[model samples]
Target: MQSTDVTQRFLFDNADARGQLVSLELAYREVLAKHDYPEPIRALLGEMLAASVLLSTAIKFDGLLILQARSSGPLSTLMVECSSDQELRGIARYADDITGDDLTDLMPDGVLAITIDPDDGQRYQGIVPLEGGTLAGALEGYFANSEQLPTQFRLVADGRVARGFMLQSLPPDRQTDPEQRAATWEHLSILANTLSAEELISLDNQTVLRRLYHEEDIRLFDSGPVIFKCSCSAERSGNAIVSLGREDALALLDERGGEVAVDCQFCNASYRFDRDALEELFEAAEERARGLH
Candidate 1:
């Protein structure tokens, strides 16, 4: 049976390569239900969500992996983040008349940014031009130009379900033959290229691997669950209000009829602050600042 909202890692025993397969069902639906997105934007958002999960698995950091597409076109920005624990959240900002299925049409002259923020270390970010017509192609270009690794990605999403498969070549081991390693990577990539969108979305991990690399020695690992989790909270919202300064917060509250409402873009959760709550928050912030001084 197929598992929904899970990511599976696999390795080739005979080649210096690794891959990740991801399928998102409930989590995808949860994100879409938060807002009404056009078909093109929804599909692009779904692909980015799936890509974030797949890319996160390859990183050894203990924080978050964020994928962002920014452009001046109809689709202004699409952001997706995946935590180390496999939690995911995403949002898309686009114009109302976003039409066309091509990435270039939606995000013309855009840039793709991949950021890795570790829990306790320096952050790293890479930017690549969105030259290709597809998100997968842009990602492949990122790897080629920045990481210099031979990578391939197959992403498919139909709003209800999002699926992704990633194949990357590992650096040749000291003991491995360089020519043979190259040959193995080339062969595996050729087979992976034959995968279709229908098979990736409908088939299980094991079945998909078998269909693609039935002749190769592949080791599939246990699957990990991916959940739709928002890292927003009342405390965080309060802190944001505090950053606005006490006077501005109070003025905004007064202008809004004594309540300031903040809505999270990722989950659409609303946090409202009235006079009393704002006063308490500002007082606490002042006390903390005093203590620091």
Candidate 2:
């Protein structure tokens, strides 16, 4: 059976290339369930989710990777996040009358920002102009500008499932000849371009490889699970409230009838804080500050 909610890595044993395949079902549905997004928005968000997982696994890091896009078109914002552990959550904001099907139509003049925040090191971010009218195109531009690696991506989402295929040329350590390296990358990219959206979303990883690279030496890796998990909690909500200062926090509580409601946009999880909770939250924050001093 075709695997769902899983990501797998594959490598070309005979070429200086590697790739990743991601198929998401449950995680995609979970993210869509949080809000009543339009069909186009749903499809775009789904693609972003799949792309995030593909890029996350492609890199070596012990932190979070965020793909955020902003524009002046109907689709104002698109954000997808994936952690090193494969946990995923995403959300999109669009005008109610949104009817665009492609990135250019939906997010004209948009810019995509890719951020990698390592657990023990400095965070890094790269901004790429949203070119080629698709998420995959924008990402290819990012790799070309930042890593200077030849990369290509095929992404598809029908609101039911989201699937992605990424192929990148690794450093030419084994193949020192520049001409051969270019030829190899071109051959692999051409074959990968033949892959259809239907096949990518429907076939298993092994089948995908066999169908795409039947003439090449391919090395397939084990698959890993991808899940929808929002990193929101009462503690985090309380911290946000405390960050607003005790006076404003209490004022907002009063304005909202003695309670402040904090809602997580990703998961639709709500956290409510009353007078007692707010008072105690600030008191504890104050105590921590004093201790630090």
- In candidate 2, clashing pairs total 0
32-139 per-residue lDDT for model 2 (tens digits): 999999888898999999999988987789999999999989999999999999999999988878877788899999999999999999999999999998899999
- How high is each candidate's TM-score? 0.96, 0.97
> What global local distance difference test value does model 2 have?
0.92
Q: How many clashes show up per model?
A: 0, 0
The collision pairs in model 2 are none
Query: So what's the TM-score on candidate 2?
Result: 0.97
Worst 10 residues of 1 by lDDT: 172-181
lDDT, candidate 1, 165-242, per-residue tens:
999998876318878888888889899999999999998899999999999888999999999998999999999999
Q: What is the C-alpha RMSD of each candidate to the true structure, in Å?
A: 1.5, 1.2
Q: lDDT per model, in order?
A: 0.91, 0.92
Model 2, residue 278: C-alpha shift (Å)? 0.8
- Alpha-carbon runs more than 4 Å astray in model 2: 1-3
